[model samples]
Target chain A: MEFLSYLISGISLGSVYAIIALGYTMVYGIAKMLNFAHGDVIMIGGYISFCAMSYLNFPGWLALILAMVVCTALGVVIEGLAYRPLREATSLAVLITAIGVSYFLQNSALLIWGATPKVFSPIVEGTQNIGGLSVSNISLLTMAACIVIMVVLTLFTSKTKMGKAMRACSEDKGAAQLMGINVNRTISTTFAIGSALAAVAGVLMCSAYPTLMPTTGSMPGIKAFTAAVFGGIGSIPGAFLGGILLGIIEALAKAYLSTQLSNSIVFAVLIIVLLVRPAGLLGKYVPEKV
Target chain B: MLKVNDINVYYGSIHAIKGVSFEVHQGEVVTLIGANGAGKSTILQTVSGLLRSKTGSVEFLGENLGNVAPHKIVAKGLAHVPEGRRVFLQMTVEENLEMGAFTRPGSEVDSGIADVYKRFPRLEERRRQIAGTLSGGEQQMLAMGRALMSKPQLLMLDEPSMGLAPLLVEQIFEIIKELHKAGTTILLVEQNAQMALSVADRGYVLETGKIVTTGTGAELLNDDAVKKAYLGA
Candidate 1:
C-alpha cells in the first residue's frame, strides 16, 4: 500500500515536471534557446493566479483563464524586450540574457509578493479511491489534466500548419524563413505557448500542494530542465518521458533510501544516463556539414 | 524585375560584397558565376533581404527592398531558396511545402501546394517522408518546389547544384530552365561556372564581391578571359 502511494505521488509530481519540461524542450527545440527564465515565469504564474483567486475574488475557471492571459502577456513582453535584441547575438549572449531575465523576474516577484509562502486552496477537494488505492483528488486531476494537455500539444505540433512551421524553425531557422514562414513570429508564438503551458502547470501544482512560495518554482524548474536534457532537449516526447522517469526515480529513492542523499541519488542517475547516452535517450546525433 | 545598384554588404568590417551591381529583367534567367568566396551568395542574400547592404539599393519590381525581413520579402513575391539546399530536415516534404506558402491564404496555399506536387511529381510520392531522408537530388527538388509554393515573381536560387550527382545537376538546371519558361524570373548564384553560364540568358562574373564582367551568357562562355579564369580552358 505504501509503495502504491509512493508510486502515485511520484507519477503526480512527474506529471507536473513533464508539463514544465515541455516548455523547456519546446523552446530549446525551436529557438535553440535555454530560456532560463522559464522557472521564474511559473513562479509569476502561481502568484498571478493566487492574486486573481484571493484579491479579485474570481471564480475558479475565470482565475485560471486570467492567470493564463497574464502569463501569455508576460511571455510576449519578455520575448519582445529581452529576447528579440539578442536574437542575432551568439548563443552565449542569449543564454546570459536568459539568466539575467530569470534573476530579474524572480527578484521582482520577491519585492511584490514578499518572500513568504502563500497557501492556495484546491479547486477540487477530497480524496478518491481507485483500484483499492486512495489518492488525493487534486493529484489525480493534475495527472489527468497533464496527460490531456500533453496529447493535445503533441498532436498540435505534429499535425497543424503552424506546428509544421515550428518544427521547421526548430530544424533550421534560416531554412524556415526561406520557406516564407515568419521566423520571428514563429519564435514569439513558441515562447508564448511554452510559457502558457508552464503557467498551467504552475496553477495545477499550487492547487495540489496548497503552497505558493516566490521561489517555489526554482528547484522544480531546474529538475524539469534536467529532465528536458535527459530526454533530449530538442525532442518533445523525450521531455515527457524523462520528466516522469526522474519523478518516479526520485520518489522511490526518497521512500527506500535516506532522505539526506535523495538529491545526490537523482544527480547520480543523471550522470549515469549522460555517460551511457551522450546525445540523450531520444536525441539524434546530427553530423556537422563541412 | 530586380535591380541591384552599387550595393556593398559588410560582415562586421569585412567588405564581403563590395560595390556589386546587376539587373535581372523580368522573365530572364540571370546567373552570377564565381569561385568560392566570390560573394555570389552574399549578393543573393542581400537581394532576398537576409542581409542588409551597407550602401546601395535593391529594387525588386519597382519596390525598394531596404531592411525588409527575409519572410516579408517572400510576401512581396520574392523567394530565396538559400544555399546548402537548406530544407527543414526534420519536417516531412509535405510540411516543408506547406510552410512555403505560410503567408498565403489557406485555400490558395493548398492550391499552390497542389501546383508544386504537379510540378515535382517525386515530391508527391515522398510527401510523407521527412525531407532529411530524401536523396540529395530529391532534397534539391524539394527545395525548389518549396520556393515555388510561395508563388514567387522573382525566385532567387543560391547554389542549387552544389553537392549533387552530375546527372542530378543536369536535372536541376533543366528545372531552372523550365521554371523560366513558366515565367518565373530567376537569379541563380553558382560556383559551377560552366553549367550556370550555359543556361543563363545573361551572366555576371563576381570576383571578391564586385561585378568584374557582365554579358550575354554565350558571350561570357566564349570570353577568353572567362575561359582562362573560370572555364579552365
Candidate 2:
C-alpha cells in the first residue's frame, strides 16, 4: 500500500516534468537550439500567477491563462531578440547565449521577488480515496492536465496544416522554404507553444510542492532536460516516457536507499541509458549521405 | 518566361558563377548541359533565390526577382526541385506532396495532390510510406511529383538523374518529355549530355561558368567540340 502511494505521487511528479520536457524537446527539435531559459519561464509563470491570485484578487483559472499569455509572448520576444541574431552562429555560441539568458532571467526574478520563498495556494483542493489509495486533488489534476495537453499536441502536430509545415522545417529548412513554408514564422510558433507548456508545468508544480522562489525552476528544469535526453531529445513520446521513468527511479531510490542519493540515482540512470542507446529510446539515427 | 542576364555570383571568396546569361521562353524544354563544377547548380540556385548574385538581374514573367525571398519565389509560379531530390525523408509521399502545395489555397490542395498521384501511380501506391524508405528512382519521382503539386508555370530540375541505373535514367527523361508535352516549361540541368540533348528543344553548353555555345538540340548534339568533350561518340 505504501509502495502504491509512493508510485502515485511519483507519477504526479513525473507528469509535471513531462509537461516541461515537452517544451524543451519541441524547441530543440524544430529550431535545433536548446532554450536554456525555459526553466526561468516556468518560474516567471508561477510568480505571475501568484501575484495575480493573491495581490490582484483574480480568479484561479483567469490567473493561469494570464500566465500562459505572458509567458508565450515572452518566449516569442526572446527568440526574436536573443536567438534570432545568432541563428547562423556556431551551436557553442548560441548555447552560451542561452545560458546568459537563463542567468539574466534568474537575476531579474530575484530583484523583483527577493530571496524569500513565496507560498502557493493549491489550485485544486481536497483529496479522493480510490481503491484504498488516498490521492490529492492536485496530483490527479496534474496527471489529467498532462494527458490532455499530450492528446491535443499529438492531434495538432499530426492533423493541422501548420503542424505539417513545422515537421517539414525540422527535416530540412531549405527544402521547407522551397515549398513556400515560412521558416521564421514556423520557428516563432514553436517557441510560443513551448513557453505556454512551461507555464502549465510551472502552475502545476507550485500547486503540488506549494513553494515559489527565484531558483525554484532550476532543479526541475535540469530534471526535465534529463528526461528529454533520456526519452530522445526530438521525440515527443520519448519525453513523456523519460520523465515518468526518471521520476519513478528517483522516488524508489529515495524510499529504499538514502534520500540524499536520489539525485545521483537519477543521473546514473541517464548515463546507463545513454551508454546503451546514445540517441535515446525513440530517436532514430540519421546519417549524412554524400 | 524566365531570363537571367549577366549574373555573377560568389561563394565568399570563390567566384562560383561569372557573367552567365540564359533565357527560357514559355513552353520550351531548355537544357543546360555541363561538366561538374561548371556552375550548373549555382545558376539554378541563383534563379531560385537560394544564392544571391552580387551583380546581375533575374526577370521571371516580367518581374525583377532580385530581392525576393526563396518562399516568395515559389509563390511567383516558379518551383525548384533541388539537387539530391532532398525529399522530406521522414514524411510520407502524400505529406511531401501536401507540403509542395503549401502556398496554394487550402481548397485546391486536394486536387493538386490528386494530379500528382495521377502522374506517378508509384507515389500513390507508397503514399503512406516514409520517403526515406523509397528507392532512389521512386524518390526522384516523388520529388518531381512534389514540385508539380505547386502548379508551377516554370519548373526547374537540378540533375534529376544524378545517380540512377541507365534504364531508370531513360525512364526519367521520358517523363520529362511527357511533362514538356503537357505544357510545363522546364529548365533541365544534367551531366548526361546524350539524353538531355535528345529531349530538349534548346541547349546551352556551359564551361567554367560561361555559356560556351548555344544552339538547337540537334545542332549542339552534332557539334564537333560538344561531341568530343561531353559525348563518347
- Predicted model with the maximum TM-score: 2
Model 2 agreement with the true structure over A108-177: per-residue lDDT tens digits: 9999999899999877789999999999999999999888887887788777999889889989998999
Q: Clashes in model 1: which pairs?
A: none
- Work out how many backbone clashes candidate 1 has: 0
Model 2 clash pairs are none
Q: Which segments of model 2 are wrong by more than 4 Å?
A: A286-290
Per-residue lDDT, model 2, residue A260, is 100
Docking class of 1: medium
Error (Å) of candidate 2 at residue A177 is 0.5
Local distance difference test values of all predictions, in order: 0.87, 0.92
Model 1 misplacement above 4 A: A286-290
- Would you estimate the TM-scores of all the predictions? 0.97, 0.97
